[model samples]
Target: METKSIVLLFIMTAFLTACAGNSKKTVQMAAKPIMKKHHSVVSQYPMSLPPPVVESRMRTVEDVVNNFGPYATGQLKPYFRKAGVAYPPREVTFIALKQEKKLEVWARDGGEFRFIRDYDVKAASGVTGPKLWQGDKQVPEGVYRIVGLNPNSNYHLSMKLNYPNEFDWFHAQREGRFDPGSDIFIHGNSVSAGCLAMGDEAIEELFVLTAQVGEENVKVIIAPRDPRLLPLDPEGYGLPSWTPELYRMIAAEMEGFSDAVKVSNNRPFYPASSPLR
Candidate 1:
């Protein structure tokens, strides 16, 4: 009986020891940081584009403005002051030229669109039209969001946009092909194979603009031409038939964009703020 009891005790001790060892191993494994499936330095920010996906970086003002004259001067100042952005948010505008296959930004107050500057691009596999499908070889049309931004990236600085939004996904789902790549960005001038690219300087300006707008305020308008009608006479420009439709669509979509800002005759004004001021 004594021997039997002793054997039972030994067995219990061995079992407990094994359990303790297993617990330690489990804890060590749990302590390891789990990596995201596509985590990158440039994809760190929640809004804006990053270089990890786009392969772009920030550049100085001289590179963007001195080379390309701005569409409007000092227009960026209000946004800069309002957002307390460092450097001069005082003079910058983003230009997306479908015909030129280029996306550039310039610093200016206003005068002429001589800001004929050009930025580097990665792989652009689209034409001057709206992207309809995943493998359509066309960049998207309409306004989109820079929902993600990152400073550290596999390529360089970059900002990420919520490409293939709900509308895009819905369309894809209907076609029974849901395997769309989600990491599209406005990154450094690298080969996209299917993405848009902007030079380092232009991206920097974009970063500043996005930071000021709180990402939510950042609006990307890819149009056929500059809307200001600087080079062409507004009356004689003879816009395409699709132009009016597009404009109306945008205006309708922007309706009720701001609950506080009231629109009277297609103009927006903040009623909460005093008119006396």
Candidate 2:
């Protein structure tokens, strides 16, 4: 009888040990998954760079370009016409000059074809080309930003461009001259001092498109001439006329821009006159 009691006591002690081990192991196993999820949440929303509060906000031109196609069915329908060449509709496009006195919109994704939209422009006092000097009453050129929409303007509607960029200010300082009256725009029918003018309907459409995409995301490219007319090769244009020192400085700036934006173009290497096929 004593031997039987000893065996039964051993079994009970062993069972209790097993239960204790399992309880510790189960707690550790459950904690691992919880800890993993906690780490993931922390890594995704670090304090240094918090995630955007609103995911739908448009922060870049690329975002706007990629999304503009889906918004075309509304008032923007008129801007859509059958494409002339074999090209997919692009998201990021530029409308510069057209034979129909219109703007040509091209897409980054659309391979090669450009869409043409008729627009009326008020050229500076004399020409249809890019404005070079201040007070030439000419539109300032460079990569610009369209920031606001003016509904109560003398014109039907107007969108603002952030012009007179850093380069312009530098040039002005170097030349010891300041060009007065520099508020240029892509606006409505009240003839401009030197802004691009579109009809009321066109401006309204542009306003809607730009507003949907967010003003800060739009970039305006004002060139001496449309780049489509220039050559595409990077190695062939005769080098720019600059002293060794100036060339190095310019090349450095170009390199920095390329690195920051990951865009490489041959146009900078050649004169704007070279024909590109």
Candidate 3:
């Protein structure tokens, strides 16, 4: 009976030892660090220096020449000659007039931009106003820059615009807004929801020109009207209270390209002379 009791006690002790070992293992697991998911904007979406996607799709001068060789040589070269500007200008400016339905291309001259060509904005949704929020359908009226170039675009070749610039962001944040829609572009196809639709031929010229000049050196100015001729009437347009200040800022920038229209007076260099087929 004593021997049997000893064997039973040994079995119980072994069971408790096994349980203790499992408990210790459980405690170790609980002590292990729990990885918390990062939520900060910078952490979640780390800024990539020399963004890989942009670099991969970046167009070369040869690419531009190959795609738009004829137009660049036959048409654009003569236009630049007449404007007294060099071909493949060091810098380029795009002025988009919503009311006039015009998109003017300009090249850097001695001190200012000289007009190169003006293409009709085949179609653009919304009236004369700044794009307030996503789905507002308003063509944004502000200074923007070319942020991307898509050679293989659904709407033919397209040049993406940097909308919601610093000013746009500041106002949006102040107004407690988020998700101010994007993907604005100057593209081919004579149809638009809230973008500049400059037809196939026009977009090809623009795309080639932008590719040659380098997207970083291209500046885009979008406005309700020719600010130089007809000044912005905030009240007349029934714009927000803060718009007058914004208009003033845009007007100041527009003043720098006042002489751009002179290229229109130079008839010999007009696009009609050597139209892009």
Each model's TM-score, in the order given? 0.43, 0.47, 0.70
Per-residue CA lDDT of candidate 1, range 1-277, in tens? 9999999999999999999999999987776544442354436765476444664665543443443324223444454344344333334334454444545443332332123233544445554444555565555544567787666545455778777777556655776657654666776655553456665655655655555445664545443333332121122133333445554443443332331221222322222111110
Model 2 is weakest, by summed lDDT over 10 consecutive residues, at: 256-265
Preferred candidate (lDDT higher): 1 or 3 = 3
Name model 1 segments beyond 4 Å from true: 1-95, 102-123, 132-137, 223-277
Write down the TM-score for model 2: 0.47
Best-fitting candidate, scored by lDDT: 3
lDDT of each: 0.49, 0.50, 0.78
Q: Candidate 3 — which pairs collide?
A: none
lDDT of 3 at 164: 84
- For residues 1-277, what per-residue lDDT tens digits would candidate 3 score against the true structure? 9999999999999999999999999987776533233233346566663323534665554675696867756667888888789978999989887876788888884567877777888988877667878888778889999998887778878889999898888888888778776888999998887899999888888888887788999999997777766577776546766788888988998887764464446422222112111
The clash tally of candidate 3 reads 0
